[model samples]
Target: MATAFKQIEDEAIEMARSVAYSMPIEDIDMTDSARFVDNTHWAFFERLRKEAPVHYCANGRFGPFWSVTRYKDIMAVDTNHAVFSSEAHLGGITAKDQEDDFILPMFIAMDQPKHDVQRKAVSPIVAPANLAVLEVLIRERAQKIFDNLPINEPFDWVDRVSIELTTQMLATLFDFPWEDRRKLTYWSDVTTIDVSAPDAKMTRDEQRAILIECLTYFTGLWNARVNAAPAGDLISMMAHNPSMRDMQPMEYLGNLLLLIVGGNDTTRNSITGGLLFLNENPGEYQKLRDNPALIESMVPEIVRYQTPLAHMRRTALQDTILGGQHIKKGDRVVMWYVSGNRDETEIENADAFIIDRARPRQHLSFGFGIHRCVGNRLAEMQLKIVWEEILKRWPMIEVIEPPVRVKSAFVKGYERMMVRIPG
Candidate 1:
């Protein structure tokens, strides 16, 4: 089996080289697969995972981007912050929308000291200890959303279940009015979508404007709470915290935006992705039904399989060599976590979905080192709730229609999924 897979991968390598070298450099982004819901993108990632693990793509949709597939290669890039830094000086963590001299210094794009300061401000609230308080609320909301999924009919799971549940959770956490929860998802989607397609509805400038307006309003809410002598909300937590030294208003806003989107979209997609996977692999779904106890172990497998965030880009701080590839100072390195999680070298029986694996949660989806997802526990808790409620309410689900993937590769998520929910 191993030898056969290797032969197949080698053939794919040659195919990729022929395609990459001959293709026009002008169009190299992942947009081509936006509407194609099948696993073509995953197939492309699988090919790279085997051949030229850290290969380069000089021209594509994102344009002249470096590709880092395979588990070890992604781990190498993810762990070495000093060598593969997130500083915008190199190019931020993305290959597109890069302007000449503009900087959007979110904490995710900065190195220590600066990253440390802003990260520290929000650390207390998201820590496992503090976040435990919200599990009840999160679980309750997830259950309500799952139940409303039309147990006997077909519906769009992405909008109704995924987006709706996640937005409500974000609103609850951010202290935003419940009616405005959808706006959080709206902003997150607009902000994360790549500004490349000629028909792209929202431009980066427009997104920035919306982001600024939203943050200004949030800041006002935080201020009102502060002036009222009771900082009860998440914004209030940040604004009134004396420990938040040297944190600028923009930094605060960036962090807020990050939390709103990060907390919402990734988890939402994971939910939809998990359900869609289970629907496609009914045998695996049946296996889970038989071993319902495996849900705990399955959480990690779900994360590994779905890999909510497709890729994260980093810039080289200085001239360095990665897995024999010459990475010069200021060169951007893109790490494809989706490919890494599926790398056969690291995972035995890498292609199959195994929920009962001994160590299933081992993937770079939540990232690594200091920048690892702070809300990982909350995300897990949410998934657990969904699965728990799923088995309790309805034991069988059918994929009436194939899932539709989001347009952007940044977040490889379901834009539409139709399933038959048997009550």
Candidate 2:
């Protein structure tokens, strides 16, 4: 399967390269992760925002779709959930159209009453009270992780720091076994990896096997939680909550994937991205070092700059007009959060990384309206704690070279980031 995917990826990259030079930017399908992995999507999106904020691509990898590139336009679509649906059955929430076999009915991909009810069930895990408890645990874990790293020697920060810290937090969220937490990171990466990308290590069958293993492990946890009293962990919350207690097997798997990816990607990438961004902008790093308190504002800026989840795809429920363009029922409309975060109109000097921006939180890294990221506050808290602890220990964690980035349009993340902590 990997062999096949490699072939497809090769063709996709060639196609992207060809279209990049030949076709008008608006007509180019930015859905190809290949374009993103190569870092060419930035210019493509810039053109879209300037020329065609509500542009249509008649032929895209995921079939035809409209790209909503501007911040205001994305907000309008995000807030108007009635016209633009996130329901999984109606092509789900991605530019890469959901396949029937791969459908997982998570609340993020659902609509209205069902989405609200199910979301309510697990909202407590990230609620203010829970976050306060998690903060102490997160700091303790960050200390342990930082203490164990090799000093004065180059190591992969993505694996040692970013993935480790997030995976630890994820385990705490689910009450997953400490030793088996790495499996959560594996599953999260596998869940979002584009099989066609060269970086995808597993074959299709292998990926399925791992996911089945994840479901099976969680099913055991769910079964145990169902019989026990209510608890703070995600599984226990779902088990005890009336709305989610009777979820179908696939539905359970779907929610599990959602929670895993949701918990894992955003913070993990931001941790790695914050390092890379600081390396790129030495002045910001110095500002942060001189005034460690800036971490409060810097955390959200990292999320915006990273834009972990690049886009959220919404389906047109009925014929509608968005940004003065006629959108047909069933047409896929993708809100490019990555592009919107950089829109100069909404964010001043949006392209630059300013830690102390007045309105730092006004970014679309977390989608707006009903389907906004449920664990966003939790993610921000984790990043804040990690950075706070990091500043206490190392003065600098220098990137050895350019970080190896993830090859996916959906998850804007890092694969490998080598760094050295100066002794």
Candidate 3:
């Protein structure tokens, strides 16, 4: 049964590769959400990396934009904040432009001093001491989650494991109400949903209404925290810090959404991805079984293989030459971290998921430069703890079917994945 599923997936990939090669270079649009849903975006990105490392799409779904698809090229753009900007007013960190009336000015979207100060306000949450404390809590929770799994029966790994664990962690970080923790997961999903997709769950208006509810609820918590003595939670940190304390309502909402999504998506998706990859590559699974100590390297490899948060967008602050192409000021520049992670020039046999690579951490998943993921160590610790607990208990957790992927070019994640753990 597993072989049959693998064959079907392989054929679909071959068909995608064929179409990718046949299509004209000028017509390829990476922003199409359908490609991501079908998991065919791999071929599109592969073509872009080889032929047009810095290609421009004249009429993208969002707008005209340049695609930076190589590892070195992506690194160059990511590190050069002076010339390439992530300003929210300039459309923020996504290929899709922010709505004119709905601009959310988070730190990641700001440049220079403002971005630094605001980021510093919440940076202590992931300090080494904080992570040391989190590791103990994560392991205990992971054990409880694993102990409750249904034996010898199929269940949705995404719902049962991935979403639940990540959402719980998000709730802890915000010091949110424990019973309403799933709200964080829901808001994270809504924040990244491709509203234009045919299968979209809600319209833009509906999404806005829900997000406003989230802001209202968090605003109450913020107000409460502001009056109390400083605490360790993110809300308390932001409330106490001078740099973040004076933020406007929309700015507050924007940073809230950023922390929620940033904390949720990357870790959640990689947790699910790790299981699926291990199942797909049984040899690597066997290698893991032989040496459980490999978990240190396996975690980052899983992150790289998943490449959650597929791309980050920047606007050209001024005219610049990137990959020999002239980028005009104010033009949208998208660095495809997904493609860059798979660049063969930088990573040998990049397409293959080899668990024990000598340099497992040398990938673009966590990104680079000042705007890199702040909770990266926390993320790694959670993944490491989950796998450690899993190895001590289950010998194997079988992925019974292909994962239903999220319908967004930006967030590469699973919506559902059926799995069974043998009794």
Each prediction's total of clashing residue pairs, residues at least 3 apart in sequence or on different chains, is 5, 0, 0
Query: Global lDDT for candidate 1?
Result: 0.73
| TM-score between model 1 and native | 0.88
Q: After superposing candidate 3 on the true structure, give the runs of residues whose Cα lies further than 4 Å from its correct spot.
A: none
Clashing pairs in 2: none
- Per-candidate TM equals 0.88, 0.93, 0.99
TM-score ranking from best candidate downward: 3, 2, 1
- Which candidate number has the best lDDT? 3
TM-score of 2: 0.93
Q: Write the per-residue lDDT of candidate 1 for residues 99-133, one digit (tens) a residue.
A: 54445567777788777777776676676766677
57-166: candidate 2 lDDT, tens digit per residue: 99887789999999999999999998999989888987876667867899999999899999999998888888899999999989999999999898999999999999
Q: Could you tell me which residue pairs clash in candidate 1?
A: 28-60, 28-61, 29-60, 29-61, 58-64
Candidates arranged by lDDT, highest first? 3, 2, 1
Higher-TM-score candidate among 1 and 3? 3
lDDT head-to-head 1 vs 2, winner: 2
